[model samples]
Target chain A: MNKTGKKIFINGNEAIAEAAIIAGCRFYAGYPITPQNQIPEYMSWRMPEAGGVFIQAESELAAINMVFGASLTGTRAMTSSSSPGISLKQEGISYMAGCELPGVIVNMQRGGPGLGNIQGSQADYFQATKGGGHGDYRMPVLAPSTIPEAIEHVMTAFDLADMYRTPVMLLSDGILGQMMEAVEFPVYKSKKKLPEKDWILDGAKNRKPRSVFSLMMQNPTILEKHNYKLAEKYKKMETEVIHETYLAEDAEILVCAYGIMGRICRGAIDMARKEGVKAGLFRPVTVWPFASEVVSKLGKKAKKVLVVELNLGQMVEDIRLAVEDNKKISFFGKPGGAVATKEEIFAKIKELIK
Target chain B: MKAVYTKPISLTETANSYCPGCGHGLVHRLVAEVIDELGVRERTIGIAPVGCAVFAYDYFNFDVTEAPHGRPPAVATAIKRCLPDRIVFTYQGDGDLASIGTNEIIHAANRGENITVIFINNAVYGMTGGQMAPTTLEGMKTTTTTKGRDVKVAGHPLRVSELLSSIEGAVYIERVTVIDPANVIKAKKAIKKAFQNQIDKKGFSFVEVLSPCPINWGLKPLDALKFIKEKMMEYFKLGVIKDSTNSKESK
Candidate 1:
């Protein structure tokens, strides 16, 4: 193992790929998609050196299914894609979720409801947080605002996936995925003792045969029982929900955002503070199983809330649901690849404070 | 009294959900028997496709995972890659292989993934009630291709074995039928050879079985067998489509 703790200059995609390799991801299958192409390109040669398997899958559909097969064998498998590509991957993701298999999916968000531009956008907030695929299921969606957080989230995503025996999504956008930064990739060590994968399909050998499948068509009651079992697992996963607060201890105007928007809001918050406005930021690190309670508490303390995103008010709805009281809540969005500047967010914060 | 024949140890006591004269049951038994004969039952993994054989995991008393419709090849590719020592194979029907899963099957064959594929070609979507498959015979009457499958519109039946045989990565490819006792025996031999090729690490091996879906074809079980022997075999010729393994042995 290369035990170097030295910081390396890297982009978000390479950082995530290297971090995944270091986090013990041994199987990667993905197709080339813009904004996240560097991930598959980096894994191509790096995976072979790390004694892992990497295949440039034929399509996004095939890539996710390949990850499914590898994960069934209890190997740390992952696939990465951009917006439209991720839409193609939903079927396999649903299967992995239904089968209760452990795998990591990284979606470097690009603008889309269709084949949208390759530029960075957060329009996929609804797709990522809500059930993007068919079925009543949820994946722990981790949103990292910076390169370092991207690395940490990749590792955490793997750990969470294995712990819960469920697929996890590390949601990043094109801005963070393409931005260059100096990040010191940490050596990952699991804090909790992850459960042994007693149900993996590594051949029958000395035990009764095991099957990993979700086709419960024989009985509706059986399928309902399985859904309840998954519900219980999701309830247990609530304890793992994470968020970050920046200068929100005594702020009256709360700026709520996530992913790159969160980082942008932080800069805006600092500027707002310098201008004598008590503006703060609330960022949910994990979008699904969201930071509802914390946001609600913060909303009660703050006189008003300003939700900012690079999309047309996706996460703002979640904030509204969390902060259920009729506080003066406002939203500022830049939909479809329109990059939001820190000055723009600061301006929005100024309006909210007024 | 010595036992002349018995069920393969790899098969479970769970009764199959196949139709009265479906070829899946017979083919499943052949595969299980081959796994037993090769002594790889304990170290074998099967990928079941979405079709009538969706419950194959229950029938095969070994580690099995169900892949989405027409994606067993992709799934088996990863399983074999992850655990190369374990024998991995996929069982697919016409709709699952020749139609919806065409890309996956083609790519897997092209990559020469060290896996076995049991391609059962009944020429119709048996599970979904006799829709026109990619391999549906020209002029054959399917629910989707009512009156008859128009050659101009529906196109010709896909000879997947012949198509895959042309790929350099595919080391072995054979097309056989299970319409009669003699043909059944030949089909088993082909299936066994496919598994043996994987055991020897001879790249990709495929066996396409001309199966009988009696209910879907709207025929009696006996007539279904006769149909495969008489009409299906005329278009999908039986026998080895490609065998680079034999040439390698000669060399």
Candidate 2:
């Protein structure tokens, strides 16, 4: 039994798996993919111990579909994969979104576009925040900068998914997935407090039979109405935007990033501050319902805003959209799994201040 | 006032969208009847496929969820795994089962998923207007195969029942048709047994019903039945392909 605030040395992938188990995830289906394979490996043994079900699906497609099925039963279901595998799962994810089935999908992203590399990259930022699947849909994406934060984010993702009756994503990366860190696991939450899933299909029983589907071909009007309803839900979800600002209250240079890049920027900003440069970090934890208001407000106060990422300027586009003033924002990116070092980022901040 | 020919309570009052003379309605009735007979209607969950039976959730008066195109088996596998005590089944068409969803079905059977599969093999892509299915008969004419399905190009019609029976995890596999009253009875029996095997905790029961598609086959309703008897049945034999239920009956 995991006690409250039990600290342990754990890898990111295993931490995520254990965190999900603590979050009341009773069913998990996943296919083996790089960087995220430890998640399934850990789940295979731990799930059985927790009296949960674990399936090594034939493909990422099957794994996601299995999660979809499990989700319909009102079980806390999840699936994790790297970039390529996550691409294959988009079909089922789209279906789940259309059906309003709630589940958590973890994308321990590696280099992408197509089987790019087994190294950490934030190239999937656009894919994760935008509708990766084919639909007018948005999923809440939580990007954790550290292992301990990843645990809390995983729990938050499940709660958000169930609260909104929608799919939520815990967006991690290969570096975070492979690294080990000291983490304090929160106590397992009892499922009793979770919102009742009155719409779930555990057989009709005494109630009227229910159907879950996305095919509105029979009536286009029905689909149109559903689309507008989803838009309203997304508008409501925009309020859940979360972010963190480090020493930005009095800074001329605001370095904006997320996930591992956020942690790196914090280090770089500190290095600049030590050397008499007014630099700070702005990290959006929920990248989808982005902390645009905070970024917009902070960007106005700062003389220059620099966006850094593992990919070639993905989230920078969102920052640009948020900060609006094209002249005030700049981007420094390392494409194709190459990570930015603290010195490299500090140099960019120094140049921006000058 | 004997209740002899009353509609099965498991079926809803929704008017089926299936074409006149289509076997789906009959098979639906049979499945509903089996659920009623087994007294599992309250605990039965159906996974509907994306083809003609996409609206099965509306027809079946029990909880039903739609699976993506050709993914009913995979969906059913998860549902059964999550709720072991609840009866779970998937209804899929020839194109959905034999073509796109082959991987899911094969693996589900191999894993011995305790669920039932009702495979309606109409031998052509009926919903999409008479396209060539993997189970489309050799030299058969359809919209995609205007020159008749070339076995050299399109491959032979898949014998799903025979293929699934070869797997050790599959406890029961049968192929039956609903061309006439006798064959319809046999198909019903096969479907019932498939559900019963699931109820008895036997693993991976499958029943492949060789059905008729009058509109897709470009034949009259009566002629479509004749076509099944004369052409379809000869290619896909009617019998229990495998039965390990009795060999290891322990529910």
Pairs in clash, predicted candidate 1? none
- TM-score on 0 to 1 scale for chain A of candidate 2: 0.97
CAPRI verdict (incorrect, acceptable, medium, high) for model 2: high
* Candidate 2 lDDT, B1-251, residue by residue in tens: 87778899999999999998998999999999999999999999999998999999989999999999989988998999999999999999988988999999999999999999999999988888889998888999989889999989878888888888889999999999888888888888889999989988988899999888999998999999999889988999989899999886554
Going through the candidates in order, the fraction of native interface contacts each one reproduces equals 0.86, 0.89
Q: How well does candidate 2 score on lDDT at residue A337?
A: 83
Per-prediction DockQ: 0.89, 0.90
Q: Note each model's CA RMSD in angstroms.
A: 1.7, 1.7
Kindly provide the TM-score of model 1 when superposed on the true structure, using C-alpha atoms.
0.98
Off by over 4 Å in 2: A1-5, A188-194, B249-251
lDDT against the true structure, each candidate = 0.92, 0.92
For candidate 2 chain B, the 10 contiguous residues with the lowest summed lDDT are B242-251
Give TM per candidate.
Answer: 0.98, 0.98
Candidate 1 lDDT over residue span A275-343, tens digit each? 889988899999997989999999988998999888889899988998886557898998878778899
TM-score of the second chain, each candidate in turn, equals 0.97, 0.98
